[model samples]
Target: MKTGSLIAMLFPAFVMYAQPGKLVWEENFNSNKIDTSVWNFETGTGVNGDWGTGQLDRATDRKQNVAIKKGVKGADSSCLVITTRAEEFMDRKYTSGRINTKGKASWGPGHKIVARVYARDVKSMGQGFAFWMLPDEKPVGQKHMMWPQGGEIDIMEYVGSIPFHNLGSVHYAWSYENNEWQSWNHAHQGFYYSFKDQEVPNPSEPGYGNYPPAKNDTIAGSWGFHDYGINWYQDRIEFFVDSTVYHIHYLNDGATLNFAKDGENEDAIEEINGKRTGVSEYSNHFPEWHPYEHNMYIILSAGVGGSKNTYGGPISDAAKFPCSVFVDWVRVYEL
Candidate 1:
C-alpha cells in the first residue's frame, strides 16, 4: 500500500472541523516533523514569477522559514509553523514558507477540506497567509488554462493590513472581447467575513452595510486556532468557519458563464418586477467547463509583501518581522 494511504488509515483525528462525511485523510502535525510523503515545499519566487502576486518573499526550505514546533500553546502540542521574516535571502528582501499537496493527495467533487490555523495577533504588518487549492492535473495535449481559467479556490485568506478580516473566493474563466486574454476579464465570486464582529460583508461593494451577525463567538482566542473549511460538490461550494456555514455558491443559479465585458454589471444585483434578483453576470455560479469539477490539491502558505500591488500591500519599517502562521492540522473528508 502507498505511504499516504497507510498514513490515512492509521492516523486518528485530534479535533474535528464538523463537516459532513467520513474522515479519509489528515495531517495533525503532531509528529514534530512535516510528512514529506504528503507535502512538498515550494521554494523561491514561485512558478508564475512572484507566486502570481508580485509578492516580495522568496520561499525557502530552511528551518527558519518552515518548521514544526512542539508544545505549541493552543495547538495539540505540535503544529506546522511558517514564518515570514524581513531578512534578505537569495537577493529577495523577505523570506517566507510555502507548501502544497500536489501528487500525494488530490480530491475532487464530493469532498470537504478543512484546516486549523492560527495567525496570532502579533501586530505584524504587510504580510498574509492562505489556505487555498488549485487543480492537481494539467490538461492533456491541449491548450493550457492558466490560473483563473483552470479555477482557484481560496478557502481562507488573511491579510495583515485588513486585520480580523477573512476572505473566501472562487476564480474561473470568463468571456473575452477578443482572442487575447485579459486578467480583469476573469469571473469571480468573493465572500468576506469580519472575525472581530462575526459579520459577513458584501464582497462587491466594500463600503456597503454589514450583513446579519452570526451567533458564533469571535475568532479571537488565546493563540487563535480556528477551523477554516469548504464543503465542495459538483454544483456548488460552501464556505465554513468553525463548522458554521458562512457562504454558499451554487453552479446552477440561472446565470451565464461568460460576461460580454468587465464592469458591465459591477453591482451584481438588479431589480425586476419590484424585486431585486442577482444579475447573471455577477452570480456565484459555476459553469460545466470550469475546472472545479476536477480534482485539486491543497496549498498552505505565508507570504510577505513588498510592492504596492503585493498581497496585503507594501511592507514598511513599522511592520514587525518574523511573522508566523501556525497550522494545527489539515484534514480531508469524503462526502
Candidate 2:
C-alpha cells in the first residue's frame, strides 16, 4: 500500500446546540480516542455505488487511514484523521472511517433524528466525503428493496470538487402503473434535492440542456470548519449547514403523490388508491416514502477518483500526502 500523509483542520471553538428536544446520545470526539462503546467499526469496502465501486478496497486493518488524536491546543477538542493509502496502477487513493450506532444507538420510528458535525481538510479536488445514514437491515422478504425503497437520508454530502458546499437528499420508492414487479421500470419514480454555493450548478438554468454546467472556486478553503446537520421527523425532514436551512421536504402527500407512480396508466391509479390512505399514513409508515423508518446509523468516508470530478479527472496528482477530514463531534438528539 502507498503511504499517504494526513492534514488536520483546526476550528476555533467547541459548542453544542439543541432545540425543544431531549439529548439521547452524542460523541464529541473529546476523549482523544474513538469511543468503542458508541461506535462499531465497518471493515472492508462498501457494497454499493454511492462511494464508487472499488474505493474501499484500499482500506486495510491499519490506523493510518482512521484514528483519533488530541486536538491542537486552542483549535479543536479532538480530531479524527482519515488518510489515503496509495495503490499501484490506481491513479488515486483515499481511506476514511465509517462508524454506526445501528443496534447500539438506533432510534425508533417516532423520535426525531439529528447530528451536528464540523468537517474540514477536505481535498481541493478529485475526492468527496459525506455524513449520511441508511437502514440497518430490511425485512426478510423485502431484501430486493434497493436504496430509496430501503430508504436513504443524506444529512450532508460534500463533493471534493465543490468542498465549500454540501448536499442533502432523501430517497424512497413509489409504486408504478405496472402491478407486476417485472414491468416496474416504466412505473418507477423518485425525487432528488441538493443545495450548494451560488457558483454550483443550477438544474433550472435556461439553455443548459439536460446536463448542468460546472463551476469552480476557491471557496472550499473558506469552509475550513462549518456546522452541518439535519432535523428528521416522522412527517417531514429538513437539512441545514451552519444553522442555515437549505432544503425542506414534507413527506409525500396528496399534492405531491402523483409523481409516486411510474407514468399515467391504469396500473398507476390502482397502486396509488391501494397504498396511499391518508396524509399521516403516507408520511409515516408508507414503504414507498419512508422505507428507512426502522433504525439507521451514521457513515463518514472519503472517495478519491469517482464520476463526480471533472477538472482533475479521476485523481489529483497534486493532493498532498495524508489528506484528512477533521470532525469535531457527532451528536444525535430526539425531537
Candidate 3:
C-alpha cells in the first residue's frame, strides 16, 4: 500500500484530529457584489419543463430578485437574500432567485455541507426555499446521468405550505429498463422534521392543514436563523437540522440484489427453470446502481407554486407577496 494510505488508516487521528471539522470553503456574502467566481445565477423557467415540478416562478438575474442586503436586523452582517415577487414576467406570475455552484465547487464523501438560513418570509403558501445538491454538471473521468437518474441530495427543503415541517431527501433510480433507460423510475426516500417541534404531524391528522381546504397556517422561521446540513459518508448520509442529526440513509442494508448483479435490487427473488429469475421477469424494472458516490454541486433556490398536497402548494389567496429567504452563510467542512 502507498505510504500515505497506510498512514491515513493507521493514524486516522493524526490526519483529522489536528483540525476536526476543518472549514475548507465558505461564503459569508459580506462583499458588495456576489463573487461570480463561486456562484452562478440560474435564470429561466427550466430547460424542458416547469423547472421539473410545474413551479409558477421564473428565475431571474435581476438584483431585486437576488441580492446582498446590508444592515440586516438579527443577522451578524450582510445576508444573501433570494426574493420571490408576485409579478407577471416571462409568462409566469412570479419571479424568484436561484443560484448554484455547478462547476465552481463540489463536494463528496467525508465532507459536511451546511448553511445558516433565516426563512421567516418563506412562510405562506406558494413559497419554498431549499439548500440542495446535484451531481457535477461536468464530472471528470466519468459519465453522468440526468435528473432522477443522476441523483440529488436535499439537505433542507422548507415550504410555506408545510407549516412547521421541513424536509431532507435523496433521489435515485430504483429500477429501470435497458431499452427505456432514460426513465423516471426513481425512488425518493427521506424524512421530515419540524422547525418548531421535534415531531412532525401526520398529513391525515384532522387539524393538519396539509389536506383539502388547506390550512391557513402562517408560522414563520425557527428562531432567527437555523443551521441545516448533511454529513456525507461513503456508505451512508446523515441529515442534520440545527446541528442535530435527524435522519440517516444507508447505501447498503444487507439486502441482496434482485438480480445477479451484486446488491443492486432489493426485491424478492423468483425461480426460472431452477435458476433465480432475478430482474428478467420485470420488463419495466431493473436493478439500480449506487449513484451517490460522485461529486455534487450546491444549489440554493426559492420557488413558488404548488398544490396543497405538495411542497409550496397552491398559493393561498391570503398569502402575501414579495417573500424572501435569507441565507447568512454557507460552509463546507472536512470530516
Candidate 4:
C-alpha cells in the first residue's frame, strides 16, 4: 500500500567517455529525467540497514531525493543525484533513493564497467553512497536464489565518517565447520580500504581495519569526478580507482551457493551466511564459502547513516537535508 511520490524535475543530458572495448551500455542521465527504460527504483527501507543496523531512512522516488540535474562542475555535463535528508517520512527520520538495472543490464565474466561518481560533500559526507550489483535471478527449485548464494559485487562504497577512504567488497554464503549455512562478506562489507591517513581502533585485533595509517588525498570522489572501475575476470574481480588497483577478490571455480537445482529458493537448512550486525573484518577464507560464479546487475544508491552501530552511522550532524551523491555517468564495456 505504501508508494513513493515523484517531484518536479530539472535535469540535463550527459556525454559519453572515450574508452576501449565496445560500448555495450551507458547512462548519460541527460534526458532531463531518469530514463526508466534502463533503471528501476527500489522503494522502502532496506533490509540490512533498516532491519538490522537501524541506519538508513526509507527509499523513495521523490525528485527531492532522486533526480537528474547539472553536473558537479556545471551544466556542460549531466548527472544523477541521490539525496539524503533529515526530515521525517513514513516512520523514518531521513529519506533517500536507490535504483538498479535489473531486467535491463547484467553482466558475467569478461566485462568492464566504470561509473564516474562524486561522493562526499563539504558539509554532509558521513552517510553512505554505494555502487554495487546483485545477482541476475538464477532459477532454483521453485524460485529465484538470492543474496549469499547469488553473491554481491560492491564496486565502490564510501562512508562520510571515514572521510578519504573507499571500500570494495563481495558477499557469499558458506558452510561452517559446524555445517551451518552462514552468509559472509569480504573485508568488513567494505574491505574498509583507506586512501588517506586515519586512526585505527583496537589495533591489536588482527585484520581489524586498514594498517600502517598512511595519509593521502584520494578521498573517493569528494570533488571533481572519480572512476570506480571493475574488471570482472572468470576467476577474480579487480577494483580500480583510475589506474590504481585497490582490491582484488579471487574467486573459486564454481558457484558459491548452488544449493537448489531450480525452482525452489532454500536449500537443505534455509540459512544464509555473512549477515553483519555492523561493519566487521574480512579475509580470503573465513566463513568458509566459495566465490559466486554468476551474472549480476548494477545498483546506484545513497543513504544517511554511518556513525557506529548503523551502516555508516554516528556521523556529524552537520549533514543536513538535501545532501546528495552525484553520478556523472555509468558505462559498461564488452571485454
Candidate 5:
C-alpha cells in the first residue's frame, strides 16, 4: 500500500468517570513451556484453501530456528523465542510455529481485546507473523473451508520484506452458490491501512511492480520491541502501535455505511462478483451485515514454504536451519 503523511490540528480535552478495573486473561511465557492454560496447539500441515493452503507442521524439538528459547525478554520479564525451520519443501525450507486458543481460551460475544508482542528477524516471506482472532466453530464444509463465513479478524499481519508496515482487516462470506465450490460466493470486504511515513510506495500507474522502500529514515529492529495493541469496544475498534493510535473505525458509523453503499455501484459489484448473484445479495456478507457480536479465538502462526509464502519466494536452501521469530508475551484484557 502507498504511504503518505497529512497534518491536522488537534485539541485536547478530558473528563473523568468511574469504571471497574480487573485483569481478564494473560500469558507471560516465563515457563520453559508454552502456557497450556492460555493456548492449545492447532497441529497439522493445513489443508489447501484461503484459510491457509500451506503446510503448518508442529515442531517436536526446540531449536533456535523453531523453539522456545529462554533468557530473552521484552521490556518486562523473560520472553519466549518462537523460531522457524527451513526444512519441509523440496526447493526451500521455511519453518515457523502456530498456536491458538480454539477451545482453551476462547472469548465469546463481548469483551475488550489487547495484546503486546515483539517480533524480529522475521524471514522475508509474504505471510509473516500474525496476531489475530477467528471464530471457534468450524464452518459448514471442510474444517479449513470455514473462512469468510466462519469469521476472521486480522489485528496485525506483516509481510516480512516490508517491516514496520502492517494490515488490519476482517473477512466473512456474503452468500453461497448452491452450497458447492462452483457456487460459493463472497461480496463486500474492507481493510484499514496505515504505515510509517518512510515505507509508503507509489503505485506503478501503468503495469509494473514498484519496489521502493519506505522514503523516511529506516526504523531499526535493534530499537527493540514496540507495543502492538487493539481495543475492541462495542461501538468502535481502535488500533495502536507503540502506544500511538494508528487507525480507528466506528461500528455502524457513517464511514462504514458509505463504503457499503459505494460497493453497490454496478461496476464495483460486477468487479466483486458476477451475474449469478445480485448486488444486494452480495452486500450481506460483512460483519456489518450482522452485529460484530460473536466470540473469537486467538491464533499465532509463522508459515514457511507453500502457496502463502509471501516473502518474495521460499528461503534459499543454504539459508535454511536457522531462523526465528521471538515473542515477548501475548496478553488480553477487557476494558
Candidate 6:
C-alpha cells in the first residue's frame, strides 16, 4: 500500500478500485504545500462545545486561515482555501479553517465522495460553511462521545442565510438514555437551520427528523462552482448535485428503518417516536462502536459560527467580512 506518492492506506477498507473516476482518495490542492500526505490542519474549538454554531469562532493555523490559493475561477487545479476572517484572536470573534483525513485515510462500508466546490458568500446569520464527515475523531466510550453523540456526516451545509440553499444531513443519538438528538435530512432550499428548530409550519408533521423536504431538487447556486456527492452504500445513501439525483439517505427500506412508504413506516415512525416506537427504535441511532463501525474520515471546512444547533437564527447583516469557501478537488471512490 505504500511506495508511491499516494494510495498507501493498507487496511480499514477505504476502497481501491482505480478507474471510472475511481481514484480511491485524492486532494489535488495541487502540491506546493499543505498536503501533509493528505491533510490535517484542524486546530481547537471542536468538542470544546458549540460547533453547532453559537459559533463566535476559533479554529486556525492561519495561512490566512489555511490556503493553497488561486481563486475566483474555480477548480481546474489548485484549490482548498478556507477563510473566514473577522478576528479577535481565540477569545473568539471569528477565526476559521479546518482540515482532516484523521490519522490518515479511513472509510468503511462502501464509500464514495466528490468535492469540487466554490460555496456561497453565506450572508452570515450564524454562518456554517462546510463539507463534512466525522467518526475518526477517536475517543468515545470511557466518555468522549460528541455531536449527536458521535455520528454525523453532512456532505455540504451552506447557510450564509440560506441563499440558493442546499444541505445534506445524517446525525444520530436519538436517545442514548436521553442524550436525545436525531436527524435525517435532505434539506429544503429553505431549511433555515431546520427551520429554526420546529413547532410551526405544520403539515401533519415532518418539521423534525424522519426525512422530508427536498423531494426533487437541482437549484444549488450561490457563489457557483458545484458538484457535490456521497454514495456510502452498505445500507443506503446517495445524494448528488451536479451529477443529478437529489437524495436518499436510508438504512434499509425492505427490512425497515423508515422507507417513505409502500411497506409503510408511519411517516417514518411518526418522525421518530410519536407513539409507535418500534423498528428497533430506528436502528438504535447508529454509532455502535469503533468510530461507527470502522474508519471514516475526511473534513474540509470554512466555518464561522453557529450554536443552538447551527443556523439557529439571528445572524444576518449579509454576514460579509471576508467569508469564503472553496475547494477544487477531493475525490474518493470504489463502491
| Regions of model 3 farther than 4 Å from truth | 1-20, 137-144, 176-184, 199-223, 255-289, 307-309
Query: Which residue ranges in model 5 land beyond 4 Å of their true spot?
Result: 1-21, 49-67, 88-92, 108-110, 137-145, 176-184, 187-195, 198-223, 249-291, 305-321
Per-model RMSD to reference: 9.5, 12.5, 9.2, 13.4, 9.2, 19.6
Output the better candidate (2/4) by lDDT: 4
Candidate 4 residue-wise lDDT, 178-231, digit = tens? 323344521233344434322111221122122212223353346446778787
Q: Which ten residues in a row have the lowest lDDT in candidate 1?
A: 208-217
Candidate 3 achieves a global lDDT of 0.67
Query: CA shift at 314, candidate 4, in angstroms?
Result: 2.4
lDDT per model, in order? 0.66, 0.47, 0.67, 0.59, 0.46, 0.54
Q: Estimate each model's TM-score.
A: 0.77, 0.66, 0.77, 0.71, 0.67, 0.31
Task: Give one digit per residue, the lDDT tens place, for model 5 in 1-335.
Answer: 10110111011111111121456787767776777676665544454422353434333333443345666555466665656665563333344567788777766433546555555554344335667887765434544434455556667665444444655545555543322343254432323223433211122011111222333324522235655556654444545555444344333322232234343422111111111111111223343323245567888766544343332233333333344556676766655
Q: Write the per-residue lDDT of candidate 6 for residues 1-335, one digit (tens) a residue.
A: 12210221122112222123456777778766687777788876765444655666688877888888774574698887788778788577778888888879877656678787876455445555777777765453343444555566676776654544456656554335333334532112111112222211223222212211132322423446777767665544544555443334444223232333243222121222112111111222433532234456878876665644454244555567777777888888876
Count: clashes, candidate 6: 9
**Backbone clash tally (model 2):** 7
What is the number of backbone collisions in each predicted candidate, taken in the order shown?
0, 7, 3, 26, 21, 9
Question: Which has the greatest lDDT?
Answer: 3
lDDT of 6 at 334: 78
Q: Candidate 2, residue 323: CA error in Å?
A: 1.2
lDDT of model 4, residue 242: 61
Better of 2 and 3 by TM-score: 3
Q: Give the TM-score of candidate 4.
A: 0.71
Task: For model 2, state the Cα shift of residue 87 in Å.
Answer: 4.8
Better of 1 and 2 by lDDT: 1
Better of 4 and 6 by lDDT: 4
- What residue pairs clash in candidate 6, if any at all? 52-306, 53-306, 53-307, 54-306, 54-307, 55-305, 55-306, 122-160, 125-315
